[model samples]
Target: MPITLPNGITAIELADDYPALQIETADCSATLALNGAHLTHWQPSHTAHPVIYLSPTAILQQGKAIRGGVPLCWPWFNAHPTDPDSHPSHGVARIERWDLISATVEDGSAIIELELKASPVIEAHVPFPFQLKALFNLGQTCSIVLETTNLAKENIAVGGALHSYFSLSHIDNATVTGLQHTPYLDTAARPEKSAVQTEGELRFQAETDRIYYGSDLPARIHDAEWKRSIVVEKAGSLTSVVWNPWIEKAASLGDLPDADYQRFLCIEAANARHDTRILAPGSTHRLETRFIVENLS
Candidate 1:
């Protein structure tokens, strides 16, 4: 069923089971998929370029991740905390179809909520069961709040992130701020992982993958070529992962263009690695993040 909204836009079916919800608000325009409650696009109407970067070769399938956009990583982050060989890369949340809970336009902003309940398939991968909900606000300050509550009788440790892929004019033309002196482990570094302190505005030169901990400051990507800056702020998150696969690694990704490495940067608001959250039974943990775009002056 194609549901029409108050703004006269319809959420059309993009797949047999997934409906791609196109949103047009006064502040911006965006698209979301019910599958994983994944946000695929978001651009402020005033901006010249798309704020959220989506890969050109991104595959839109039922079970596969869309490669780009804002993929929700939950229950676990990266390889399984316990089972690295067999579990999903991020978690079970992004691969499962979430049920629509509500959708409404509030003060010219699109507010949508989607829920996911645990079942046999999820149980097979994760021992603990959970009830999850994702709230999206596509407007001036694009926001996403992920709520996960443990359903089992015992406490459960969970990790998640709003893995945001941001658009940039070019890799060399951008620099990251607000994470100065922050401690991070460079997972892609050679001779085992290297723990280093960030100095000044971080610039990318190669395949970069770092897990930053103990930081609550807003990370800003200053894009000189695009003439804009992206500010990422978060709450209830203690970890941030910054990455950009330069040339060789980008060519190896089947769902991403080879040159896309110069076009995007990922500054994620995450509770990952050592920043895992523990939720008691019937208690919920909310991971919230907001994206604010500012023109460079």
Candidate 2:
């Protein structure tokens, strides 16, 4: 029988039949789908395409854009230009399948918990053998929770992040505020420079790629043309990443349209290189990020 959770949420039990899970919230207003127990689609509003969608049903990675969707990429942020064994551009978890344990729907949202036990497939590529639990909560205010437990006898080195691709009407008319006087590594220029201080809000004048480190301030993106601003609050993770491919790099992504990059920006919470964290046996760590869409008009 299908289990009916709180807040008008329901979970279909198909663990023995197939690798699909469905989560529905109260009022039957919103629904999120999972394949192989990993988040696939987060549809907030019924009259739309979707708020979040992950491509390749099995991989749980590679999110393709549609409308106002936010793609969730985990474990790693961007390419480690210096390291090759870091596991793909981000990490191995994105491509691996996760197993669902339970779910709860409450307060106009649904929270589904998924777990992954280390296996030969993951161990072959990733040296660390650890247990991972990803709690994905879908609602009007959605959040994907990531928790890692060190199960291996030896201490392990791990790096992780949540990459959120926000949809915007226009990039030129948007300004990001919050990070002030924060230090960041500017990846746009050659020789790779770092900023000790920022003049003001970071604006997308051209192709921008910078990783801001050690900031607890909340950041916001104001879309002047759309009359809407998105506020982001971070907990557990201290670093913030802002990226816009602009013109040049956007053209290289064959899956993206020529004008797509101008309409979206990636504000990610990441840990890389020097910021990487390690976990010892019987230890655990967590990272969380929240997005609130508010009306500016």
Please, what is the TM-score per model? 0.95, 0.80
Worst 10 residues of 1 by lDDT: 1-10
lDDT of candidate 2 at residue 162, scale 0 to 100: 68
Instruction: Write one digit per residue (lDDT tens) for candidate 2, span 11-51.
Output: 54333423445555642244333432344455454323333
Query: Candidate 1: misplaced stretches above 4 Å?
Result: 1-4
lDDT, candidate 1, 142-206, per-residue tens: 99999988888999999978999999999999999998888888888875474656478898888
Clashes of 2: 2
Off by over 4 Å in 2: 1-75, 80-86
